[model samples]
Target: EPVEVVVERALAAQAVGIDGVIASGQEAGPIRAATGAGFSIVCPGIRPGGPVGDDQKRTVGVAQAFADGADAIVVGRPIRLASDPQAAARAIQAEIAQALAAR
Candidate 1:
């Protein structure tokens, strides 16, 4: 769904005492715009620039997610499917550190 629709639903949920949601990195911008700091958005399907399977959509990188306004990010495939899972995890953590520092 578009970020606008996501935000609308989030707002509706917030009206009923909800404050957190899982969203795409692409929706981060509109989420921040509409809900500001109060709503928590956890971005999933984060891809770190590699060949991807067709199962995931609306994916974004760690840096882009943070830059656009995702409060948190979930990284899975990049690490799970990597030749060196440990290294991939380290790299992703470093990327997360850098993005957080930039913030």
Candidate 2:
């Protein structure tokens, strides 16, 4: 769906008792327009800034995700496929902290 249309979906979901949306691509910008109204945004396919290895090209870095108004993020492939899963997890955690601090 077009980014703008996702906002409509978010609104519709809220109308039906849903509480959030999994924003991606440029949808975050539009989603933020609904900010004061209240709702959560969880961005998936979040990676550490590199060539997106999987089909979910709709990806964003940790900082950018937060900057774009993601309430939370789902880190998958990156940590699971990392040479050191523990370090990758920690790195992502640190990135999240930095992003939150910046906010």
Question: Best candidate, TM-score-wise?
Answer: 1
Residue-level error in angstroms, candidate 2, position 89: 0.5
lDDT of 1 by residue, 57-91 (tens): 68888888988888899988788989999999999
The alpha-carbon deviation from the true structure for residue 55 of candidate 1, after best TM-score superposition, in angstroms, is: 3.7
Candidate 2 runs further than 4 Å off: 35-37, 50-54
lDDT by residue (tens digit), candidate 2, 1-103: 5776788888888779888888783577678776533788888888876336578777878888888788888898899999999999999999999989998
TM-score of 2: 0.87
TM-scores for candidates 1 onward, in order: 0.89, 0.87
Q: How far off is residue 96 in model 1, in Å?
A: 0.4
At residue 55, give the lDDT of candidate 1: 79
**Model 1, residue 75: displacement in angstroms?**
0.9
